[model samples]
Target: MELSNLTGFLVHRTDVKMTNFFTKILKQYEVTPEQWGILLVLDTERATSQKELAEAIDRDQTTVVRMIYSLEKKEIVRRIQNEADKRSHNLFLSDKGMSLKTKLMPIVKAAHDHVTKYLSDDEIQQLHEILSKLYATVKDE
Candidate 1:
């Protein structure tokens, strides 16, 4: 079969394209997609443990740690020792991060809107379901 006809190739290309789009959108703010994810998840979850942030962002702990370090350097996130578990830290958006998040969120929304604007609501829903099922099928391994 032609490479273009392969499911993996198509999915990979789509992911790359989306990543590139977001990279361009976020370049001025100096945030990677993974970092943006950490910020968003922390803000949404509110004072989340690193483990929780890792899972919510679909990233492994090691990668999350690295991303968190970058975020910490930028003063985008702060890590606090979990009161109950002194070993693990809870992550929160720093004041600078919150200000940046406030500014970046609408741009993020607009970027996503541009991505799905061509699809009908039903199509978009179907796409989400299909992607979720695909991830669920392979995520464990």
Candidate 2:
């Protein structure tokens, strides 16, 4: 059987393509897709726990932790002790992170808009719903 005939192969290829596109867009910002994802989420929330960050980005805890650490070293994100749970740390965007997010948001939106430019609003919604369903199917297993 041809590898290209497999749905998983197509999905993976598309994922790689999108990631590469975003990598180029984010190159100067020095943030990867994962880092940007977490930064975006942190920007929305006043403070979020590491576990929450992992869940929000649909990533494993270890991966999220490592990315957060990198962001921390760069002074983009900092972990403050959770007041309620001293053992846990809540994530927050530093002034630097917020500033970067502001700059990155427009470029990110433009890049995404460019990718979906040919799709109608309805088509975009339908595609998103279909992808979410596919993700749930495998993720729930």
Candidate 3:
């Protein structure tokens, strides 16, 4: 069987292409896909510890810490000393980050639409379900 026919290869190839696509779009906004993931999490979850943010984004704590530092440097994210845990901090998007998110929501939606233009609603739903199932099956291992 050809390498392209392998499930792993196809998934990875698609991921790389999608990341590249997003990278180009996000570059103008001064955000990387990884940082964008953190922003989205903080936006929805509100104040959360770095550990929680890492878990929510399926990334390691150290990596999340580094990302948070970068976002902080960009003035897009702020770390407040956690009242309950002085050693840790809760993450929040700054005013600038909120404005950026507001601007990005539409473009991100358009990007999603562009990528899935060829897929029907039902196909898209099925794809989501399949990917979620696969992710769940392997995520704990």
Candidate 4:
């Protein structure tokens, strides 16, 4: 196989492994990977509409809505009607969600560190850039 093909195969394998590891770790917090993604995004962006979250996370609206409902039921998130746009509801992390984010951030960081341990700092930087470029390419399609 060509180098590119080999890299693609490794990427796929690594993604599966990473997902499994993350799922196990996040389970302790009673969160799935999808829920974690939403939490992380809300942590950084603060109050945002579900539509915005869906676009930012590159997930379908239906999937996002389902995740939102689950998180809301867990008291990890709350939906507030948009004052200006009655048709839209903005999502915000609840006190519980904020607490969870604070508690779980170190675990997330450690997982990331473990996964990238084999790469040198420069290689890690390059890898990020390459991945960003790849994402942009596909996002434009």
Error of 4 at 130 (Å): 1.1
Q: How close is candidate 4 to the true structure, as a TM-score?
A: 0.89
* Leading candidate by lDDT: 2
The segments of candidate 3 whose C-alpha lies over 4 angstroms from its true place after superposition are none
Per-prediction TM-score, please?
0.94, 0.94, 0.94, 0.89
User: Which pairs clash in the backbone of model 4?
Assistant: none
C-alpha lDDT values of all predictions: 0.89, 0.91, 0.89, 0.88
The sequence of per-residue lDDT tens digits that candidate 1 reaches over residues 1-141 is: 899999778999999999999999999899988788877877624788888988898888998998999899999899989889999998999989988888999999999999999999999999999999998898998
Q: What is the lDDT of residue 138 in candidate 3?
A: 88
Count clashes in each candidate, considering only residues at least 3 apart in sequence or on different chains. Answer: 0, 0, 0, 0
In candidate 3, what are the lDDT values of residues 53-138, reduced to their tens digit?
A: 98989999999999999999999998999898899898999989888888888888899999999999999999999889989888
Show pairs that collide, candidate 1. none
Task: Tell me the tens digit of each residue's lDDT in model 4 across 7-67.
Answer: 6677788789989999998997899988888888895346799989999888999999999
Q: Which stretches of candidate 2 lie over 4 Å from their true place?
A: none
Question: What residue pairs clash in candidate 2, if any at all?
Answer: none
lDDT value, residue 86 of candidate 1: 91
**Alpha-carbon error at 18 in model 2, in Å?**
0.6
